[model samples]
Target: MPGHELRYDVNCSILFTELPLLERPAAARAAGFDAVEFWWPFAEAVPPASQVEAFLAALSDADVQLVGLNFFAGDMPGGDRGVVSWPTRSAEFRENVELVAMIGAATGCRSFNALYGNRIPDIHPGTQEETAVANLAFAASAVARIGGTVLVEAVSGPQPYPLRTATDAVAVLDQLLVERDIRNLAFLADLYHLTVNGDDVPKVLTEYADRIGHVQIADAPGRHQPGTGEIDLDGQLGQLERAGYRGWVGLEYLPSGPSAESFDWLPRHRRGGGADQTNEGDG
Candidate 1:
């Protein structure tokens, strides 16, 4: 319970995969979480209006606040990280930007994660970077209308993702600030990915605390529940708190067992940061 003081939000996209997509929000609420986050929930950049309504209705019915969301990353299960850096997909990314903004307006969700896509084999790296910068600028501007922060994350994988460290992601943020004067852009400190990519998490927490717009966690070695892996999540979270990050800590780990059963490490009261309010029992 070292980091019990921090507010936590369930990443329903990962945590409640056993249930259908629409039921995940309610499942989180049932597990005693008041807020949740997710990756792009649909198969396409813009789903049909009916699908959109159903997705929103699910959140409303569950009565959970959406604290974070990702812009439409291309076919994730098919190995696509994002379309922002793909020159051919600029229009798709921009269109999704508008859709994401609309969703944010409806849900009061302010933090948006924009995954920088992987390297293209045929395209020049310079061209990809240029496309990424322009797309990020567009995303930042669009989300700024709703008082939102656009998050850049360092992903860990073998697919040639460009941003693989806190410094790598922050460099893009810095470029946006200095060149475009975009203050709404920030880093998404995903500890599991950063650790997998060999970043010194403690050093990152100390050096770039202020630049972190959102935070996500899972245990390292295997992206499982906190106590099941090697990362000292509590200590790192304690450092994050001392360094003044008061944002929602997203539980983005894959459940080691049943989703409901995997939350034994986090008491129900602490999950919502309502230590004084008594819950029936821990989930």
Candidate 2:
């Protein structure tokens, strides 16, 4: 096996149908996946903390890894896109770190993806970068203690926010990680966003290959599965392989149907071992 890891997001269906957290792993496993990824698991209102253990245990029993958790949504209290630099909410950043750390540990996650809170309409672009770097540095150190790492993602161009380029994300993340001397931090290369932001992804992947800790995929326009969009999935996958990328490649796309419907687009038979082909669309 090539050692590549593929995981799908719970939001791809669970959030849409209001399914329980514990049902996600089996649902994904049934969909031909051996792992799962999701936005902040802590943001969900159901499955009180006591049930977290059982949910994670189910994934383990099913031979699945809960690979990725997303941006700290808790910062929404400061503003919809909560970056640490929001003037009135230094405490929000601290709270997000603690809350996210707990969520990562509970699910046995090894990676967390950080997004710069949506770029405020009137804020200067440089200001957002400064805030994001500071916040990432603070948050990185915090998650490191829990055995999980942070992977900063570049927001898509069509999306609001000044930090819309992969170069922007990589520059800031690199500077912050180096300054803080944190080896646990890295970049999350999402081809969907990279294309949306007009980034030369393969070039970036080649240059900063060492800093890329995670990878994500989805087709363009609607952010659907790889086979349904304009992004060059084969080229990007090949680029990562050529660059020596050995980490997990998260299936972070909206399924055209239930996730199983998108399996043919994944590199299931590559270096990564083959997934057990089984019941693929029951939650």
Candidate 3:
């Protein structure tokens, strides 16, 4: 019986070169999911255009949706890999923005996850954040042109980025909202990062719930499956509901073994088939 609790769509990254992309839709659908997400493919894989079309075809055949895709690494002209304060890499940064837009256009994905990257000790915190805000603003405009949104992930590690803290992310998002006057730009709430960053899950969710456009979950420490970590998977989900987060909650974690094994941790549900092909990459 389906529980009364509202459930969000679960998405898995489908870039397993070992496993054919064609197989991904069936696997994800079999696991009672309707969506998936993934990072950019390297040049070695299918050419960008072919890759995009193949994924679109797979979703159409399997009745699943491509929810998110990460932008190419570093920078490309007009692409937004999004971090503008990573060392002195200006040219590379510009390239990322252009590449992101191109990828977005091809895949029909609307949201791109921009990492804050690692932080620098020598740089003043305020200075670093200012640079990030400026860069994101530019990227947001570029993405908006292509009917997409540029989003930042709240990273948490021993060496966190300028947008590491929830407070920092919220502040920057607020600034972006006002400066850009755009609603498409948003934030990513990765549960693993939230736990490692010492955030109160429910509190932060409640506070910036409206600004959140995407959410990922994995266990802390190893960033593996949720059950392996200390974070309360069920409770955090409840928080998502209280905050009125009615969007896809991606299963954006590394599986301990085969992706099939991860299905056991999720609830059991009927797997149905449809024929609509919606390929929109988001991360």
Candidate 4:
């Protein structure tokens, strides 16, 4: 009930895995959501134009607004870490910039999450960090032209990701903003990943409220629906509101049962895009 005051968008990439990528938007619309976000829609960094058009068409047909998207993280299910920061992958990342920016411009998407690449053996941290900063500046500039912000998040995993804390992420944003003069980069506060890394959730919520560009949530331990884990999400959502964040709150959780069952924690009226919930529910 606490987060009901905030706008919510389901992350179709993880939430509706039971449906095909092209079918997920309609599935979400059926389940009462008209705003959705996704990881890059294809395994390839630059999916073919037809595939991209089909995706956009699906969004239009389902009548959902695209709220957020990830820059390709490489084969996520096959264990490939992200590539934006990798020395060898810099060229690959460069190729996808305009493609992603085009999607943002078309869909009015404002938030882009650029995952930091995994560390490779014997590769200097300075080298990777420099590449990442430059790459982020490029993305920031592209989206900024459209009045959008590029987001950096601290992913909880092995030693691959150097950004293991909010401080780490903010530091990257500050450095890039200062050096590149790009003002649109911001932190993506993903509560589930931060909690997995042992961050003090309350402190993160209060201290970083003004600096966050977007927020995503899942219950920790198993990364399932809100009430399924030890995370005090209701309390955190209330705190998020009190801290003065009025941005969209993304439901990035994986469902333990059916994705439709996941919303039992949220009231039916608040689940879909605000106005459409009524007709969607009735339909």
For lDDT, the strongest prediction is: 1
Candidates in order have lDDT scores of 0.88, 0.64, 0.63, 0.83
- Report the candidate with higher TM-score, 2 versus 3: 2
Tens-digit lDDT track of model 1 for 1-283: 6665467889988999999999999999899988889999999998899998999999999888888899999989989999999999999999999999999999888889999999999999999989999999999999889888899999998898999999999999998888899998888999999999999999998999888878899997889999998899989999987876777788999998899998999887777643232211110
Model 4 TM-score, 2 decimals: 0.94
Best first by TM-score, ranked? 1, 4, 2, 3
Model 2 score (lDDT): 0.64
Residue-level lDDT tens digits of model 4 in 1-283: 6965577888999988988989988888887877889998897999889999999999999999888889988878766657878888887887887888999889878788898877777899999999899899888888778777888899886646788889888899889878877778888899999899999889987888878878889997899988899999888889987877667778998899998888888877787655233111100
Q: 270, model 4: CA deviation in Å?
A: 1.0
Q: What is the lDDT of residue 268 in candidate 4?
A: 71
lDDT of 2 by residue, 18-56 (tens): 356667767666655666777655443233666656656
Higher-scoring candidate on lDDT, 3 or 4: 4
Report lDDT (Cα) of residue 148, candidate 2. Answer: 75
Model 2 ranges with Cα > 4 A deviation: 1-21, 44-48, 51-63, 74-82, 121-130, 267-283
- The parts of candidate 4 lying over 4 Å away from their true place are 274-283
lDDT score, residue 275, model 3?
A: 17
Per-candidate TM-scores read 0.95, 0.78, 0.76, 0.94
lDDT of 3 by residue, 1-283 (tens): 1212333344444323236756776677766676666665443222456666776677667676666666544432234333466546544555667766776676566777766655666877777666777777777778888777677776765444556667767667778778767566777888788888888877888887777877777877777776777778778877776666655566777677777676566655522221133323221
